[model samples]
Target: MAKANKKDDNVVARNRKANHDFFIEDTIECGLVLKGTEIKSVRAGHINLKDGFARIERGEVWLYNVHISPFKEGNIFNHDPLRPRKLLLKRREINKLEKNVQQAGHTLVPLKVYIKHGVAKVLIGIARGKKQHDKRQAIKEKTMKREAQRAMKI
Candidate 1:
């Protein structure tokens, strides 16, 4: 089988607010432990990562508050819309994340959920909460960059 292209990943959902509200320091791709109906719903773009987060509990990384809408065709077999899911990560990586997260203001936020080679995966970021002033500065910088690009195009 041919390998999937990096740019061709089928993104299920994204948490735009995560970038705006947090200063992302690093990103890691990890697999998700999802059920049949849950994967189906994800493939249908019924997932929401807006309020999703990950935490290390009892030596395991668990994803919380991710909403994967129920599959339309699924009746009793439909999975719950919001359920705490397990994130698959290596022990060393988990330890690193756990350590970094223990620092003040640091947290794990799901950046995006996507399908790679027919497998469900999530891109999670190790981030620190941004202050209101930092958010405003980011917004100003973004606006200035946009204007600069527009000027160059003219």
Candidate 2:
């Protein structure tokens, strides 16, 4: 088992809408390499994974649209907020994601970002885009689940 960091236990950013908007097929954990300033920014909980997605380019996995804000006290050496960052994954994992994403409407969405053992990691999931009606169905199902839980409590 991995030892959890005591202080940064909570998530920095999560695309909750991703769950509602897409059907998640698989999940993969990947390490992100960042500059010192970028790490500082992430450690401070200044990140947005809302519109972030992962892509395979040139046989490598890259995360796009993931925003890590500049350090509060950073100088000229601060990293770019929207720079495309490399994702560390096994070659086998990269091959799998590339295959699945080639299909129509299938994508890799970034679900959450958090600090694990003082390292920044992104939790990305393979997802298929949902239609408008499907989204409504998901909402209806969620509402029923919430109602059932409330009734159980009562």
User: Which is the leading candidate under TM-score?
Assistant: 1
Per residue, candidate 2 scores C-alpha lDDT tens digits across 1-154 of 9987676365677888899889999999999989879988887889888888888989999999988999989989898899999999999999989998999999999998888877888889999999999999988998999999999999
- Give one digit per residue, the lDDT tens place, for model 1 in 46-128: 88898889999999999999999999998999877887999999999999999999999999999999998889999999999
On lDDT, the leading prediction is 1
* Cα RMSD, model 1: 2.3
TM-score of 1: 0.93
Question: lDDT at 92 for candidate 2?
Answer: 96
Model 2 bad stretches (over 4 Å): 1-10
Give the 10-residue window scoring lowest on summed lDDT in candidate 2: 4-13
RMSD in Å for all candidates: 2.3, 3.0
Each candidate's clash count: 0, 0
